[model samples]
Target: MEGVMALMRPMPVSPKQGVTSPRTSVRRSTPCISTDFSKRNGCLIRAQQLDSTEASTTVPPPVSDSKDNALQLKEWEVGKLQEKVAASQGITIRRRPPTGPPQHYVGPFEFRIQSEGNTPRNILEEIIWHKDVELAQWKERKPLVSLKKALDVAPPTRDFIGALRAAQQRTGLPGLIAEVKKASPSRGVLREDFNPVEIAKAYEKGGAACLSVLTDEKFFQGSYENLAAIRDAGIKCPLLCKEFIVEAWQLFYARTKGADAVLLIASVLTDLDIKYMTKICKILGLAALVEVHTEREMDRVLGIEGIQLVGINNRDLETFTVDISNTRNLLDARRTKIIREKGIIVVGESGLFTPADIAYVQDAGVEAVLVGESLIKQPDPAEGIAKLFGKDISI
Candidate 1:
């Protein structure tokens, strides 16, 4: 009688919640399964039913649940909004980061789908894309919030434009902005035995009005560490942080690193960014060198307010093609008249290697010349300076 009572009681079950009980027979395939709680028997109800034939072969789960689908839709919507924002800002070539449904975790086998803008069409586009990813990763490590605090303790900025004017007055030529470059995309490596501090000192001794230090690590093999070291080493020449700046954060970051001046590439930045960044530079007491390669860019930049210095780049960054004549061509009667009227100091940049090169740009009405490879590659960068001007400008 006790054994009969024991049989009436239910059997013990395992503590694991989602584990199914072992069964000898497979459940039959049902026509439909409703998740509505009202239809549930209030007891054991199967949420999923598998056929006996399908039991042996694995069946895949749904691609995504409603929650995941909703998230994907939100991400896509945000991406489109960002695109619109970029377009309105005059950033035609800029691309937003890829966003979509979260990828499924497949062990030991990774699957990835290429999206639009994931691959670049040209070298210029490639560099911009790479810069976006690099800058994003860098921001995570040294956020703008932290950089702003560092600015409070940063060193005072020097007179970059004044230095150029003074040097021109003393030399009767375009003031030299000697470049401390280790490498370039067009010319692979300028100096295999590159030493930033040493190069800076040589440039100073050579009587450079200012120094342009390449702060791009990936392509130029330069870093802010180099800029700081040169500043800390008692070099008095105003240091320019040469960088491919895409965001406003970099301007603040450059100030924190002891930069007196920063390069603004017109091709890579929108007119709005240049205008806003120029204001930020004034507030920070840093000089902004607004660089342009075409007539359209010059026209766009000239229209902006408070631009003090403008650089005419001889080298076409997009094509890597250079013609020093670009300087004379850009500063035609109309543009030169406007520049002179605005009191804007014109800087001739790139493709400058010799005294003739310097003279040519100066005749075209440039007050300064930013030189790199030819000066940096010399056995004695200081001697390279005297040769550059065809005379000893230091005296």
Candidate 2:
């Protein structure tokens, strides 16, 4: 925790009325890793795929998009299958209309310069570069390789999720560490009036095992600065930095924000990336709550050794839709076997507002819960936390 304490940096956020500048800064020196990967194999793979794709009837890129990038548009059509499945289930699906093609951000990789035939190397890149955007990591200031060693590497500091696992092993119900998120892209503006320090105090008073803060500024309306304030205000609950982690740089950054744990969405990354990133989170003394929404994501996580905490997100990321039933759908009987056998601490995330909702997921097997809206709306956020817990947190 100390290793990461000096690491959590103050995020860019507007200070609330009563809040003032923090007397301390949480900046840690970072060790760097090489960001360059040779694209020779990628080019070969693309050439072969392009030849095969071209052999089939020529599918031109959508007129709305660039002509040279035609194949990517065609591939984007396939990613929509997840949406199709949700709609078929009679779930109230509010599909955000197909977005106009987006420009891609090219990463600073050397291999990107060489044109492989025309295909994207992996699915991860497909989601990233589908818009002709640069898909490589660039140095905002320092390269990844250079940041690999200058900083002190921290070890995994298990938090609420970990504590829950311990409780379950002891008495079957791990503690509930609910969130205080104000908004998410999937369900915009979760709570109208939000205060971080107050909410953390509420969660603590409500008997919450810990607090999870959505620190992403763009999508979540959350900030690391809020976390820093939450830390400075002297809350006892540990904080989870809820952000889209596209880089390990963010993990290092999370510790600087006084985060005790961090979320890693499984679908957005490959298996190798998950293993590597989770390991990195441990090295930084932050809890890595590896999240999964599907069997595939679960399988990837299960394959990794020594992973103690797992969260099942009820919300779909691609479509930004919440499916509370996802809690049940994901944790079937077979899953129970693996969970119980391996002692994996499972958490159900999103769309939970009531004690009944908490009971539903808890009955489904999640010993812990993560929520936002319901608690935020309450006059006393701590009471909301207790209500969600179905017990007196004030006790």
Candidate 3:
């Protein structure tokens, strides 16, 4: 019994031997004792607790990601609101296709499937949608700040309205605003030879009051380069930058590129947009040729103050169909009376191929005519202009 008691005595431990005082605590460096079940269980429990703590404390996403998502949501909401406003004003065309779900999640494959929400309803709508994307890319290349700076050295603007009025008074007929068109969506290519400067000079010599240069490249195969080239070539006729003016930035861009006037389609823009854009045009010394197709569109444009030039586009832009009677239908007695009172110069656009066609629109009260395909298709655009007016108006 003495030997067994002596063997069972507790051994003394030094500070370096991994023993802690009763008042202090120290983590164990070695693995849990396998022979001791309690120690093994405690080690497993502590490990699990540490893992639970780490799992509860998750890392947050970057701040920029959250901000970008918020911005996109706001833009989407604003777009929907704008569509509603346009619908209220009887605009059937949408500025862009409706937004859909994330492309990756919508279909089985990586690409998005074609649907009504993502597809354009008509040619006009398709053009507008494409224009929006193209404008975004252009804005990135030439920001508004740079465009504003460019305005300082831009060419002086001519009096587009005065030119038309003078031409009509001198010729005793509707003034001609000849078009420098390369190709149209409906008609593939107007002139295979397609020299913009040459065409502009011919039109000027033929007594064209102003020139319309189609500046849309995707559909029309026209460009700002053509307008600049024509202006640099010393053509006297005022040039109309025939563009789908969606934003105000385009007005500044047009002005810098030697555009004396710009086309503002009433069907594409709202009443408020027309008013605002007209004001901008006034500040920039650029004329606004607000074109209308339907009676409602004409009324909308007529109601806006300070509109000097109103164009009646006889072609249905949505359907690519032409009917000269559209100009006659929109400009009735009451509208004509209002137009005369306001001192507005009415221009009949599209589908005028003959002298009878010009006379019909003039009888309906248009002071000018915008003829493109008929004139540009002929071997001599100048002679085409004479034939269109039924006389040598240049004399």
lDDT tens per residue, model 3, 263-333: 99988999978987887788889999999999999999999899999999999999989998998899888
Better candidate by TM-score, 1 or 3? 3
Off by over 4 Å in 1: 1-92, 95-116
Model 2 C-alpha lDDT per residue in residues 1-395, reported as the tens digit of each score: 34434343323333332233222222111111111133223331111122233322222223344665444543444324433443443322222212221132233332212222233333333333321221132345544444444344522244656566544454344466667688764467867768878788877777667788877665568887887788778887777887767567777766756778888877665555566677777766677888888776786678788787889988775555788888888788987888888988788887887777877888888877777677777888877766766766453
Candidate order by lDDT, decreasing, is 3, 1, 2
Best lDDT goes to which candidate?
3
**Which ranges in model 3 have alpha carbons more than 4 Å from their true place?**
1-65, 100-108
Clashing residue pairs in candidate 3 (N, C-alpha, C atoms within 3 angstroms): none
Residue-level lDDT for 248 in candidate 2: 70
**lDDT tens readout by residue for model 1, 154-266:** 99999999999999999888888999999987789989999999999999999999999989887789999999999999999999999988777788889989999999988
Overall lDDT per candidate, in order of appearance: 0.75, 0.60, 0.79
Q: List the residue pairs that clash in candidate 1.
A: none
Q: How much RMSD separates candidate 2 from the native structure?
A: 15.8
TM-scores vs. true structure, each candidate: 0.76, 0.63, 0.82
